[model samples]
Target: MTPTPHDLPADLDVFLAAAGWAGATVEPLQGDASFRRYFRVRKPGDKTAMLMDAPPPNEDPGPFLRAARWLDANGMRAPHILADDAARGLVLLEDFGTARMRDYLDQWPDDETAIYTAAVDALVRLHDLPPGPFLNYSMSEYQREARLFTDWYCTARDLYVDAGGFSAAWEAVLGDLLPRQRPGVTVLRDYHAENIMLLGALEKQGLLDFQDALVGHPAYDMVSLLQDARRDVPPELEARMIDHYVRAAGVDKDTFLADYARLGAQRNAKIVGIFVRLWRRDGKPRYLELIPRVWALLERDLAHPALAPVAAWFDANVPTALRESLGGRFEA
Candidate 1:
């Protein structure tokens, strides 16, 4: 199926018309496996607007909308929803330009500390969102997502771990995790270097990919930051950030460590699966290149007693040949 503009579902035009975001060149922005298409619409004498076209009946923008609102109210900066048509599954948002946080990190590596600290502060605000009927980021969801490593990544690469091996490891790790998730906190489920913006003190300080936000482990976002699949933050830098986040969040030392270990494992599991899915389903091989850094980070984090079971499992059963292949790809 060669996808084209006409294939952009019919409601997009109607949404552009209703929102007065016309005559702008709508070019697709790269995104994950969602019907979401971001168009950099540049019109004559008009402030740039990012037309978020997530076609309806397949995908819903409700969570994205609600999360954006929540972030805005909580003193974090996600793009303001300029216009919304839930039925049409389209949203027009204030464009913050293309300066993503990753771009800044690449350009000015020395500015990492300040940029990351600022992002973490904003994250603190986001996580401070008061409890509500918003769905819980329960262990079950994490387990389900964690399984993606095998189902997608391993499977896509013709790699496999026996059921006994997989189950034995996951069960032990999860048992440890159950106790650690005691004082739950909101999780941005997918907060990473890429999801953030580099526009410091500008209009949109951060761009939110908060559609997957959930109430879960507090350490989740921290894990996302340190164990980023796309880029490897040095271990020393990661430790500093860990301390910064824990202190800023006002959590106890032991409590933060336990949860951090658990969340780190959870984050690694999710990314392993996601990378595989991106490759197999979306044909995105770029993620494969990052696999080694991710695995190395996971290996380092899993050195904690909390993740010993999982660490050993990968050590024993996930296969050296497979690890060598994935690890080498990531290193390159």
Candidate 2:
């Protein structure tokens, strides 16, 4: 369902004209895992804006527009929606420039502490907000997501696992952890550096990819930022940022750490399945490269004492040798 060059440009012209920019030229922008594509639109005498081409039958822009409006009203730095066609799945949005936090960090690795501190602070602000319009990160939701690891990776890899026991083990972990989560914090499910733009403002980062925002434990987004699947956040820096958030928010450090580890494992387990599915089903092989790092993070999270049940499941079913094998290009 990829758009041809002629189709995109023609659609872009129609969209731009409707948005009152009759002759704006567009340059392609980098896209994410979804089918949505972005274009940087430039008109002769106006500030550049972004056009999101979320084609119907595959992608939808309603949630994104709703999330953007909510974020704007709630004092977060999500892109402003200039105009949108919900039915066509097109939106003209404010461009936050090209300085993605990931690329910015590469140029100035020394700014890691400063950059991440600001990122964590933004998250603190997000968590502080009163519950608003968003989906709930429920226990059922968590378990359903975690099951993807078994549904895809375990099946594809021919990894034998005790299904009943695995479910019981997961239930034990979820039973302990879910009760402890405070349910109103806004969890931007993909709160990593790549989704954060280095705007160099007091808030420091402009948020993106937040259509999946939900009401969940505050620590969920915290772990997403610190324990990034795509990048290795230094352990010392991770510890320092956790402390910063703890002091800034005045939360119990021990409880928060345990929740962070628990959620991290759950998130990583889901990602392991997603990455494998991207390869085996979608035919996108590049995502397979990140599996090892994700597995390593999962292992780290499993080491936590709170994850005893989940850990035991892994130990009994996954095995040390299989854990070390990592995932990529799995044979049927």
Candidate 3:
């Protein structure tokens, strides 16, 4: 549906008018899980921009702007910041066009290797840079994320586990994994297909949703891309990408693989908790449908020897039946 004047935020009209797009057409765009809203703005003469509405107290454009500058400086293709009204929580960004990597791959599955290879190579380049200016992706941060599984997912199942015990189990696993994460590397926390865009001949790819970028383990971003929650990356392709990244980055293979598994399990576990939270707490039940896929991914990650302690915790606390069930699916 077309967004009329009344459909926009009160400040949006004045904000656009001040930016020379007062009369531009606004087309609502697909948004992420965050509170932010997005719109495609088009002028009469074909000038275009993407408007980001990130209301304050809940969301801000500062991290996004900083990340964009950092990526651009490091030879990456994050959207250029055109204008901003920081107080009103709005920013104008360069339009990277309409080809998301997810949709593109859906249409041409054969191009999987080509696109994924490009993505891996691009990420390798980003990882090679110095990690200053980005916030450290810390041990506490990792631990807190892992605990989200026990905090929310278990509650959804009407089960309870010793929170203190869970924290200790994660501490043991992360103690070994965290030190191995090559310090001083930029980790784009969400490097998955959906947040990546195809830029045709102009650029290899365009990045979106990088406000959460951090400086930490190289493996964190790699796992985020390969073991995506929303889509299944074929086993052969996942292996190829992992090998390609290992080769290009010139790192110890054994450590990288171990850390990949550790981090993968960590991320997927946190996502499981988050999915349940989204359904029961936020009243958004559609995400429950993805629980089975997420559970499968978590199982794959837990198979690694590095995740033994956490795996034991899961085996003891979360039953197989509970893991496979989705509240919304059952409700239907």
Model 1 lDDT per residue over 106-199, tens place: 9889988887787777667666767423687665676687788778766655665764676567677766656654445667777877888766
lDDT of 3 by residue, 255-316 (tens): 88888988898998899888777777777777778877777877888889998998888778
TM-score of each: 0.87, 0.94, 0.95
Overall lDDT per candidate, in order of appearance: 0.72, 0.85, 0.84
Supply the global lDDT for candidate 3.
0.84
Question: lDDT score, residue 327, model 1?
Answer: 47
lDDT of 1 at 39: 70
Stretches of candidate 1 off by over 4 Å are 1-11, 157-160, 179-183, 202-204, 324-332
- Estimate, for each residue in 1-332, the C-alpha lDDT of model 2 and write its tens digit: 44457757346677788888887777777678888888888888866999888888888899888888998998989999999988898899999998888888898899889999999999888878886588888877888889899988898878888877877877887777666555568788999989999775636679999888788888888888988988889999999999999999999999889888899999999999988888788777788788898888899999999999999888888857768776544542
Provide the lDDT at 270 for model 3.
Answer: 91
Off by over 4 Å in 3: 324-332
